[model samples]
Target chain A: MKTSNKSVNQEAKNSFSIKGYFLRHIQVCLASLGRICRSPVSSLMTIAVIAISLALPAGMHVLIKNIEYVTSGWDGAAQISLFIKKGTTEEKVVNLKNQIELMGQIDKTEYISPTSALEEFKRLSGFGQALDALDKNPLPAVIVISPGIEASSPQQLNQLVESLQDNPIVDHAQLDMQWVKRLYSIMDIINRGVMIVGALLALAVILITGNTIRLDIQNRHDEILITKLIGATNSFIRRPFLYTGILYGLLGGIIASVLIGLSIGLLSDSVSKLSSLYSSGFELKGLGVDGTFTLIAGSTALGFAGSWVAVGKHLGKIEPS
Target chain B: MIRFDNTTKRYSEGHEALSSISFDLNEGEMSFLTGHSGAGKSTLLKLIACIERPTRGQVVVNGVNISKLRKSKIPYLRRNIGIIFQNHQLLFDRTVFDNIALPLVIQGLPHREIGRRVRAALDKVNLLGKEKLYPVTLSGGEQQRVGIARAVVHKPPIILADEPTGNLDPELSAEIMHLFEQFNQVGVCILIASHDIDLLNKMNKRIITLQQGKIIYDGHEMAPKSYHNHENIQ
Candidate 1:
């Protein structure tokens, strides 16, 4: 019984010690934040620099995402026009349409008989008198096919066209490759450009944070020395500075998120007007909860890394002697 | 408790700070280290705190031979020893309460316990009512008392001071010495480095006098009261 009681008391001490450890960390972080708050001008300056650097990449990423969304809608508008042989029966054209619709890459197909094609072309082509002069109908039966949304890339659509042309009834399958190729290349270039810019801007954030933390260390040289003399461990001496760096990161991240959101909101009005003009149902999306979390997490990580580098280099040079 | 075995410290600039100095301080003993300026007094105290290692010999503090101790363990070792500086070294940015709470905070004591101990230490230094005032607002003696309060707040077994009362008046310095005596009465080993010879003789404790980086004297009764006890005359 005595031994059990002693063991339980030791266990209680261990738990309380762990609790105390975490509680101290919380206190230090709050104290560091309070310290930053006391110096509003410099802290605001650092936070602003960090926010701008982070916002650049984050804004670019969101812009690229919006572009992808708009372009994907354009992809849905792309179509393959299948022209049938001049004498192909309406029954055979409809059969081909049914077969094309069954293809995994094809979304749906529309069959237009020769008479209907002639009527539509004559009515819209401003050549009704010329078309009436012909004794026989010359327009070919056609099938219009839209590729599945998932397989609507230029390569996939071209492959589907090639396969359709092999059908006995299909005389030729045609789509505008020039614009599709241009659109895809543009998207590729923009994606790569955004990636490069994002990476460079992220590097800028780290350097900014690192320089800020370095200055903070210099400012607190006396306090650090005194703390060290009082037997504060290196980590204890390091805690507040690290918290300062993290605060810079966290605040920067939050501001960047807000900047992105505001830019999206500001641009959304113009975008809605333009999309309405083109009768597109597309809407712009800002960085959602996930992106906000990722931004904050990523910048916080960068802040931690930057401070670690600065403190590891500078803290060793300070001695109580 | 401290022991220095043939310790010699030489700076990289070729100045020898201490030369083969040997001494042992027992647990609960209170002593004074005295010399002129640049007598290696601060250097000696620094060695005991493991702030500077000897160029040659071993230093043992509280049964730990810190000469072989790793750098990572230095803070843990320092927790067993408290040091007071001549300049008081109180952070002017924080209140006296926060300054005194530093060591306890470093030790990660619970908030309630830290408050209790910091108040107790303040009471000991007779500065309990001035806890919230910044060090810059306090007088020189008050600042030194805040330093002393911080040093003893953690309740380490050993305390070291380097001219702790160097900037204070005679009355305040005597009061500080009396506070040291009270702590010594409770078995806190204290080693103080001071240049005040009159005060040292009045205390009647063991005195280790250094001259030119060497221990010239290490006897208990070398003060004027025992000048006749030494028969050897040059």
Candidate 2:
């Protein structure tokens, strides 16, 4: 009976201490935040530095996403144009177009009669007077085949063009793939460049936070010394500085998001106008929900890491003496 | 309780601050450590507090050999022993109440318990109603009292003071000594380092004197006159 009573009392004390632990942490967290709020000028300066550093990479990321979005439709533009033999009958050309459209890899096929092809050439090439002086229509009936998305890869497109060129009625089949490959290469390089810049800026953010926290430690040297003398644990002395770091990072992330949002808002109208001028329905994409969340989470983690390093390096040097 | 077994401290600059010093302070024993400024009174207190470790000997506190205590364990050791400084190391940016509440905060005491204990300590130091005032606004005596309140707020079993009354007037210094006597009466072991000959003579407690990093004397009221004469020669 005595042992059971003592066990119950021990449980009560444990629960009480657990509650006290959380209470103390909450107090320290708020006190750190209050310290930042009290010194608005210096705190804002540090936060602004973090926000700008974060914004550069985040802004580049948004630009790349928008660029990818704008160019996404060009994948379907890898069409194969088949020039038919000059004397092929129009009926045979139509039949050939129908046959190609039924192929598994073909999206759709358009047949252009020799007459209409000549007229389109004259209108587009500004050579109507020169064409009128010719004795006869020298143009050939053409069939344009758009490959399905699954078959639009460079190798598949090459295979389709080669197969079409072997047909008796087709004089030549062409697929303009060089420009597409160049576009992809450019995109890959830009993506890699953005990644490098992002990594460097992240390092810069960490260094900035670390330097700010170092200054904070120096400023509170006396407080830290006194607290240590009074039996405050190193963790207790470190708590406020860590919290200050996290708050700086959190606030910086939030402001960077806002900055990105405002810039996207400013650029939206001009981007829409440009796309409309090109007769395309493409729209610019901003940092969506996932991107914003990742930015905030990453910045907060970096802030924690920076302050952790600073605290470990500087807090131990402050002995009670 | 603190026991020093032939403790010696040497700095990296080839200065020996303390050499072959040995002493034993019992539980609930109040004693004064008196010496000239450079005679290593502060250094001895620092060794007991684990702020500095001995270069050569064993310094034991509460039966733990703190001369070789790990760095991570220093804070726990300090929590069991309260230390007061001559400079009255109160945080000037905080209120008197916050300064006194720091030790309890470090111990993770509940909010209500902290308030209750802080008020109790403040009452002891006769600063009951000045909790909201900042330390910078207080008089020197009041500030020193706040430091004392902070040191004892967590109720450690042992207290070590280094020149705690150095900045006070003679009357205020006596009052502080009286406060230490009251704490000692309640079974708290205390060792104070001071060079005030008159104050040490009046306290009527065990006194230990150091000179050139060596104990020249240790006794009660019997050695006051002789100690005074020695100081006059120095």
Q: Each candidate's fnat, in order?
A: 0.49, 0.52
> Which residue pairs clash in candidate 2?
none
Please list the residue runs of candidate 2 whose C-alpha ends up more than 4 Å from where it truly belongs after superposition.
A1-18, A81-106, A110-143, A148-174, B224-226
Error of 2 at A310 (Å): 2.1
Q: Give me the displacement of residue A35 in model 2, in angstroms.
A: 0.8
After best superposition, candidate 1 residue A182: deviation in angstroms?
1.2
What TM-scores do the predictions have? 0.87, 0.86
Q: Model 2: how far is A172 from its true place, Å?
A: 9.7
Clash pairs, model 1 backbone: none
lDDT of 2 by residue, A41-73 (tens): 999999998988898899999998888776656
lDDT of 2 by residue, B7-97 (tens): 9998778788899999999999999999888888988999998888899988888666876566766777777788888998888889999
User: Please, what are the lDDT tens digits per residue for candidate 1 over residues B16-114?
Assistant: 999999999998999999877787998999898888989999888887776776686677778778889999988988899999998888878888998
